[model samples]
Target: DVKVTQSSRYLVKRTGEKVFLECVQDMDHENMFWYRQDPGLGLRLIYFSYDVKMKEKGDIPEGYSVSREKKERFSLILESASTNQTSMYLCASSFPLPGLAASSYNEQFFGPGTRLTVL
Candidate 1:
């Protein structure tokens, strides 16, 4: 089975402090995603990468950044953590299907999740 693991299950930080969240996947998937999940807001993408050394900003990348130097690992960076950033952070990776790609965008298998609290 494919597996994704986060560096932390919970985190606490003060406002303005820098924070880093790491994720690693065992599957040799081509896509990795960083998302913040909030109540009512569902899951909003923060960043994603399809290949090593390449990344794409997602819907909410203003307070975040990401890195993908290796196929199995992805990192999320918060230059200055804030209270608003406190939420459930999830990491996912997927392997795309070639034919009928639209229907097979690779279901995201998420990590256990990191609950970050920035006070």
Candidate 2:
């Protein structure tokens, strides 16, 4: 079975602090992603890595960055944490299904997220 693990389940930090959210997937998947969950906007992708040390900025990458140093591990970094950045952050990994559309590549296995609160 595929498993994804996050370094934290909940985190609290003051504004301007640097925060690191870690994710590790058991499967040797080709893609890994970080997303933030908000009420109306739903899950907004922050960053993704398709291969080790290769990353792509996602929809809302302004305050975020990602690192994929190893195949099974991906890290999300909030360069300067802010109150508005408080949200449930999710990590997911997936393999590309043959013939599946690129957007639908998110048919993935997700980790229990890190809920961050910045004050």
Candidate 3:
């Protein structure tokens, strides 16, 4: 079965601390994405990578960065943790469908998410 896993299910950090959120997929997907979910703002994309060593900034990438050093793993880095940065972080992976439109859709498999609390 296809599986996506995060390094932690819960994390706590102090202000100004550097945080690392790791994710791994066993499906050999071509794409990986990082998203942060907030109470009212909903899910916002932080970054995404289409291939190994290639990444693109998504909607909200200001305080966040991503690394996809290998095809099966993606990492989200928070340069300096802050209370405002606390949220649920999600990692997803997908591959383009052969018959579907490029911009239309791909079935993404998501991890359980890491709930981070910045103190």
User: TM-score, each model?
Assistant: 0.93, 0.93, 0.93
Number of colliding residue pairs in each model: 0, 0, 0
Model 1 Cα lDDT, one tens digit per residue, 1-119 = 98999999999999999999999999898888999999999999999888899898989999898889999999999999989999999999888666535423669889999999999
Global Cα lDDT for candidate 2: 0.91
**Winning candidate number (lDDT):** 3
The Cα error of candidate 3 at residue 17, in Å, is 0.6
Candidate 2 residue lDDT tens string, 1-119: 99999999999999999999999998899889999999999999998888899998889999888889899999999999999999999999998665526746457889999999999
lDDT (Cα atoms) of all candidates against the true structure? 0.91, 0.91, 0.92
lDDT of 1 at 80: 98
